[model samples]
Target: MLSNQSEVPSLGPIQREQAWDQLQKNEFDMVVIGGGVVGAGTALDAATRGLKVALVEARDYASGTSSRSSKMFHGGLRYLEQFEFGLVREALHERELSLTRLAPHLVKPLRFLFPITHHLWERPYIAAGIFLYDRMGGAKSVPAQKHYTRAGALRLAPGLKRDSLVGGIQYYDTVVDDARHTMTVARTAAHYGAVVRTSTQVVGFLREADRVSGVRVRDVEDGRTAEVRAQVVVNATGVWTDEIQALSRVRGRFRVRSSKGVHIVVPRDRIVSDAAIILRTEKSVLFVIPWGSHWIIGTTDTDWNLDLGHPAATKADIDYILGHVNTVLVTPLTHEDIEGVYAGLRPLLAGESDETSKLSREHAVARVAPGLVAIAGGKYTTYRVMGQDAVDLAVDDIATRVASSVTERVPLVGADGYFALVNQTVSLGEQYGLHSYRIRHLLDRYGSLIGDVLSFADGTPELLAPITDAPSYLQVEAVYAAAAEGALHLDDILARRTRIAIEYAHRGVNCAEQVAALVAPILGWDAATADREVANYCARVAAEIESQQQPDDEAADALRAAAPESRPELLEPVPVSTPVQT
Candidate 1:
């Protein structure tokens, strides 16, 4: 079935205002309190179930942990060592679902080389685990694991030191633009009649006797307050789960601890490999995943307790990753080779183990109280399962029978007709006066809705040109970000809507003015407001760059947290009690 560009809902500024009005005038069956991947999935699930649902976010969509992921959708291969078979299987199942039916456009197959350092028992032991992994997920869309000799492995990856491994095994996984995927999920929910609004903070709970009746939300943009009534409220805030629960005046069933993960982005030429590389770290596995024109390497699993909003990556974090990755590379990478850095927190359910890496990735759902539900913990690959579980518990609070989850069958907004669009790339390029490669890039990002993005440049043909400072992106993307993708500020465009902030070495500083100007008219920003947006984005980039130079988390966080908030009211204290007047 073809997906008409007009059929996809536009979460533009007008729709955002309409959503806020709907929240005030109509009561909902469910109100979701976060806009991350899990929360977006939950909203999609509830909407597809024919539930009256509304979603609110304090910041832009995927501004937290959801966007900073390793950008992979796969069964955690390392989890096999921990014997968390069920977790791996469930994640693999979701990965297949995304690859085949749900989000074929966003999730694509990627190969990784797992280098073997020991020859004795290592190859066979690792081979057995991979064999099980390949079989566990049922039907396979990617190729099976392939064994390679030391010479063959080196042929695939000549950048690796010859002495680093005796042999290698290459397996398949998937990668995505995490922030874009999360936002698209939320957009899909919006298309199906769910109310999704960003920059709206849930300040306090509306209580009726002992049950949570609704929430009091503040517009972080203008400081305007409104009360939204719902039969049930769901808290899917990742690391801030406890903070949101406290507003209900009830103790949570399980505590969530924050585990910080960091990643660095360097040019793809730095690592000369046909397939992505996966190396073993002392705490966890490190993945050098291939990105367009770049390679993303990361993820230090460590405990973080300082600031939940802005988790900082210290200089030590970079040095640690470089130290381990350098051990295998023939041409080692220095700090100057790094292009970008990011840090995100994992909302792990606190367990008996003191080590963050030892904590379980399994999720938990609880009826915190009558008319309220909370879901936390889980890998990014299994977000759909987490959403389904959370909604199943929440249906018990509803007055009527709700339909089972249809999300497994429901493809995201842009998934349908994507393959057909791929076959027409050359024709599309000719029609749009662009190259086939640029057309394919748009198709990959927007799928059947590529026209929606291209339409922005209809009257203004200049919008079709590449961004000045960040040439990888088109100028129209910045315009589409504000016009239909719900980007309210310059930071949203630079950081999430487009990945210019992380993909470029200047970290979006040099192009701040151009992007701000491109988006100003769409966002209704005056010259002064546009200038403020550019300045704020520049300061944010400066702070992040400085923070990455700090020696430790404490110092890094202080530097990052001191940077200006695009939405200033997010820093305001959430009221403990519902207002008597509202």
Candidate 2:
């Protein structure tokens, strides 16, 4: 139940190679499809319980909904309005555990102000909800909500329109770096003994008379096919749930619909706020969350049936968010203030509601076939519960008595000695020749493993300095990304590993080549391969920019699709097997 932070799963070249070898060699107890948060969490859960597990992803880790979230480990305050007490309570419990034990390095308490539009009824109504939220979940790790008068609220957030609010209520929630957290979860699973592979696509399902046997997948990196046999197969492919179900040819108990949510990032100075803001919108809700040096305002939920991989944010989508947020802001933001934009799709279980936003956020799990257990629909906050449910059901089908879930007690790698490492920042700064502030940043980002990144600068002192193009990060970060983190491609390093892709003004073009060069030796990339990687990444940025200018879905989809994929072999579509009743 304890994770040794010093010892990582080490998904470097040799480790990934060994993972494939193990995949082909053993008939695992469980084969988990998808590498999103839920899939990664499921792998950790099963492996910790002594099950032999293998997890496969068609793309990089957290390339889907897992990374594209609003970044809050909130209990969904709005869910109280919908009378979803159970969901909110469960999420609050998980949020508390994540903050205090599981991932203190990644998830930290964040304060938010709920601006009151109406004077009397709104304050009392919101207060009641906040009161219930603080006490539920069987614990409270954050501060309770506090009331603020209009003057007090203005002092906290001066950018808001004077007439926008009569008062405010401040409460706390946890914020996270979604992609890094997902990767750490998968790495923790690897530490506990799970064979995890990215760039591995499941083309078909292996079947036996009335049950699922295993999966047949292809390594997108090289043209290699692998037959991985397992006692149980878990379908956790997020938005592509039904697609995976079709491969098994079994009638699914439910269907999944794609709901696209888009977010835009702007400079921190644009919105003068000491805390994050949550406001009510026409259809759903609007959040102005605090991201390090930037402020993220977004999330318009609407039906999306476009290219699943790159969900493009149209001009209209951007305008819609601007229009709503502009209502409460004194200084109306135009397109000029925006720095970056990202879009992600949420998989909602098909229901009676015509509105995608109104569809249930609760998840459902069922045995689609004797050995195939499928789970769909849920928010990021409840992924652990969803994962636990999937593994528990798979255990039921295996018909073997095993230990119940104990992930609550397992701290992720880097979380064990985080507080002590934070305390050592001053000394660490003196030793590494970095400023105390810089040392604190690295400590929070890497926790106990900060030493691993610092070690890259041992011989080459130049690596200790910040990256010239992206001064926020060290050159050693890019080098260590390839050598330590499981970053194989240039896009993997820029986009997910460090978030340089969305955080920079040039969309990573300025630093893409430099980062590639830094990682070239570790990845064994030749001159030709490194150049190709940079070109592909630049093209992707250009296409994304052009797509954002388009007014509608079809135009944007075409431009986005025209961009080169990071892996050339992935450009070719794989054929799905015809449905045959076993």
Candidate 3:
């Protein structure tokens, strides 16, 4: 069956205002603060369960830690070493659900080869662990983990150092476009009649007697402050959980410590591997994840006590990741091989006196107050479970009885016909006059909603041209971001919607103007506004680059903090200059 080509449902201005008005009219069943994956998931869960829900985020959706991650949807392999069997099983189940049932289009299976250097004992031990991993909690979607000899392992990952491996084990996990998936979750919530708005900050909580009744929010987009009332208020703000708690004037039962993790992206050709590589490092595990035409290698987990908004990767952090990764490389990746760098803070429950690596990846939900519930400290894979738990707690205060969460059976917007579309990809590609690979990419990102994106190209074929700087992305995507994906700024389009910043060699500097120009008309930006958008994006990228060069968090945060504020007025119309007559 052909997919519906109607505008993919989103939060419109009327609906947003209606939600704000409803908060004044009557109390809602739930009000979720923070538009990260967890928050979005909570909103979806609550809304799907027949709760009157409203989700508010201080910045853009997933602007913080959610957007900046290792971009994997796997049960933590490292958690196995800590003997956290339950957490890994739960996360692995969720990973399978996302890949097969909920969001098959966004989440897909990825294979990783873990090379063993310690000969006999390591291979069997690791293989046994992977064998158990495959059998545990809904791992049936992908093939079982396979043990490989040195020669066999080299065939999958030729880039591994010849001397580094005695053997290897190939295992499967899943990866996602984190920012897009998070946004899609919020959109799905909107589709289910939840009021979702970004650039709207919950500045303070509205309390009744001793309970949180609602929140006082400031719309950063228009600079208007208003109150939103709900029977229950959920804090799903990840690293900012404590800050949200402080807003409610309630001391949280636990503290969340921010552990900064950084990742570097390079061209796919830099690493000659058909399968992703997982290498054990001195500090933590290193993953060379395959991402489209590029490879994402990352994650240095270090204590971060500086700025929470833009966590920067210091020179030391970069050196640490490179230092670990270089040890296992056939041809070492140097500074020149680095295309882009991004750092994110993991919200770990505080109480440990040990290193950040020792902190638990487990999540916690606490009823800190009568009407307030806070959920924090989990990896991205288990966000759905985290959201469900938070809502389950908040439901206690819900006046009228509501049905239990049906989100488990409720497929995300794109998952409905994703498998069928995948099966018929070749025919669809022929119909669109595009390559089957490109069609597959579109289907994976948009699923049944690919028709909406293709509709734009149908009217204006020029939109089908690939971006000048970031050739992997189409110009149609930038246009779609503004017109359909709720991208209000150039940063939203380039950084989150398209990932040009992390994939491009110049870090989206060259394409900023071109992208701004494409999105200008859709977002109502004039030449001056377009220029300002380009300038802000460029300055932000420059600041991030500068920040990464610093030695420590303090220096890095200070350098990165120099980024210009998001000013919509800068996108206002410019006066036309009069032409000179010769």
Candidate 4:
């Protein structure tokens, strides 16, 4: 229950307690597990269609694979090589909807050059694929692809070595802050009256004979447990899909395999490219993307069988990426040039192919049990469609004729007045006594909710000052995260809300104390608790740094998993055995 001033119910500490109480006292039509993009999208779709829905997550929203993606919203270009046209077209349509209508403020069009190595057959082959890509179903907004000779390509990206390519083709895609977009979707669900809570783990399923009727959940913060009754339950967990399906004591229609993708961040000046570059790799493709003040070079796709919560990026992973990307760069990036490293797992639908890269990005939906529906294996771009599909199946269990999904016509919370606010950036800066540049940055992150974020600084203007160590972000951003964005731990603020962890060299260790102090009062943390939070965050950063130096996944997992858990009550998961299928 936030103050009456907010357009939606702000998911602060007050509202969290209310949601927990309501979960026990009332029965919902649907309860969605997992707070990743698809889970949040499902909740939003159900709520908008006039259903009482609840969403619960084991950790913070997007804490898993959703937060750690390559941060793009494009059709998988290489999938065209596999002749997956329907998947590509669906993704492109979703990308178009996001860019023009859904979240114009957060999603921005970006340019990328696909370098041509062999002179003869490469150009036409690549050109035809991109030609189909640009003219796909809903790609009316972005510019068409253009061919560039070797000299022209060098002019656009001078950092590329002359010997690497004979020519290139520059094309358009889109980029986003994945964590923020996912959080915004959750908030929009709350706006439409869905109950959403984080740091709440589903321990078991409640059953009526043969079907799931509800869930038993534990508050990770305090170790308290409650049972939530729902007519239908949706398992939207990405990597944890199988674990949850096991709890239902039912046979899942499909299995999910985790594929690890690693990315490294370096200073923007490390490459002198005006646009991003894409190169073909032996296994797949590598992207050198532009991310604000840094260039994000990534993605090694391999099988990972270690900790699903924290996917560790080993020294071998870093070396693999640098070796591939360095082939095209004028100055090869080394270990010292790296500022940040992150790894995420993709929950691909398991198939006969052993190669994780060869698995399909196409998602599947199944009515695993009478009252439980499971959806898994889709790219980030098509999350909304996956949600609609999941809910469409769950509606059969509800008995009532539910309204069709209205999420496509529904704008997210901050999207309405965003363009108007962009036009008023100068005036907003003058009124708030800040620079126009800073105002633009706030606008991009918070959109029309910028006023709600700055409202915390009404009497205390010093809160508007930049963070001492991470000067790129203001101090008030941290406060807003704790007060309104459902940030229960220091890692939630530093890693997801503001991205200071991945953008800075110290990886949020330097600013941990100051941030903890700022949110202490809002979260009702005493002096001892604040100090403990700071200590844990610093230790976590140290563990990650040490883990990255390891030679392989096994070594990295040992170091990273040994670090302290922000939610200490959440111990090792005990496997729940599935009953024999009827």
* lDDT of the structure predicted as candidate 4: 0.91
Q: Deviation in angstroms for 449 in model 4?
A: 0.6
- Evaluation by lDDT, superior candidate among 1 and 3: 1
Q: How accurate is candidate 2 locally (lDDT)?
A: 0.87
lDDT of 3 by residue, 81-136 (tens): 88999999999989988888999999989988988899668988888788778878
lDDT of 3 at 428: 94
Q: In model 2, what lDDT does residue 108 have?
A: 86
Per-model TM-score, in order, reads 0.98, 0.97, 0.94, 0.98
311-368 in candidate 2: lDDT tens per residue? Answer: 8888999999999999999999999898888888999988748899889899999887
The predictions' CA RMSDs to the true structure, in order, are 2.5, 1.8, 7.6, 1.6
CA-lDDT, candidates in order:
0.91, 0.87, 0.84, 0.91
- What candidate 1 gets wrong by more than 4 Å, as runs, is 1-5, 572-582
Q: Compute the lDDT for candidate 3.
A: 0.84
Instruction: Please give, for residues 1-582, the per-residue lDDT of candidate 1 as tens digits.
Output: 123446777878998899889999989999999999999999999998999999999999999999999999989999999999999999999999999899998998998899999988999999999999999972299999999999999999999999999999999999999999999999999888899999999998998987999999999999989999999999999888888887777778888999999999999999899999999977899999999999999989999987887899999999999999999999999999999999999999996489999998999999989999999999999999999999999998889899999999999988988999999999999999999999988887888889889999999999999999999899999999998888898888888989998999999999999998888888888999989988898998899999999999999999999999999788554333323221
Query: Order of all candidates by TM-score, from best down to worst?
Result: 4, 1, 2, 3
Candidate 4 TM-score, C-alpha based: 0.98
List clashing residue pairs in candidate 1: none
